[model samples]
Target: MMNLKYQMIIQWSEDKSFLVGFPEFPGQTWRTHGDNYQEAVNNGIEALESLVIAYQTTGETLTKPTFNQAA
Candidate 1:
């Protein structure tokens, strides 16, 4: 099993496009127009999976990535 840590933020666009990204994983982003929130999240997950696989293949190690949520 691979250990991956990331946070996602979903935003709506006027043109009916969904934008998603992880604050921790800069440049890791995905967008899907004409999709719902779930669709955007799914796309984000796929992007994360690809990123993790690529990093693991290159023997890069992730050290203690944390996510902070505020109430």
Candidate 2:
């Protein structure tokens, strides 16, 4: 997934009282949450790295990201 750049969608949930971020690829759901915006961004990066590692380890090709939605 070296050439791939996934978009991260972030939002603040009043109910959860935290920031949440997730990749925007099709079939992808859920997100990593954080106590603040910066933490949420950090979590999103970790999530993307984890995704890359998983795909690499399993020898599965990751779909190229269409855009970057991170803020």
Candidate with maximal lDDT: 2
- The 0-to-1 C-alpha lDDT of every candidate, in the order given, reads 0.67, 0.69
Candidate 1 lDDT over 1-71, as tens digits, reads 33457666788987787887766655555433227888887777777677777777999884346757798
lDDT (Cα, 0-100) at 13 in candidate 2: 85
Root mean square deviation (Cα) for candidate 1: 3.1
Q: Name the regions of candidate 1 deviating beyond 4 angstroms.
A: 1-4, 29-34, 69-71
Clashing residue pairs, candidate 2?
none
Question: Distance from true position, residue 15, model 2, in Å?
Answer: 2.5
At residue 63, give the lDDT of candidate 1. Answer: 39
What TM-score do all the candidates reach, one by one?
0.67, 0.71
The lDDT of model 2 is 0.69
**Residues 1-71, model 2: lDDT tens digits:** 24446777778787664555445555556567787878887787787788778888999887776753698
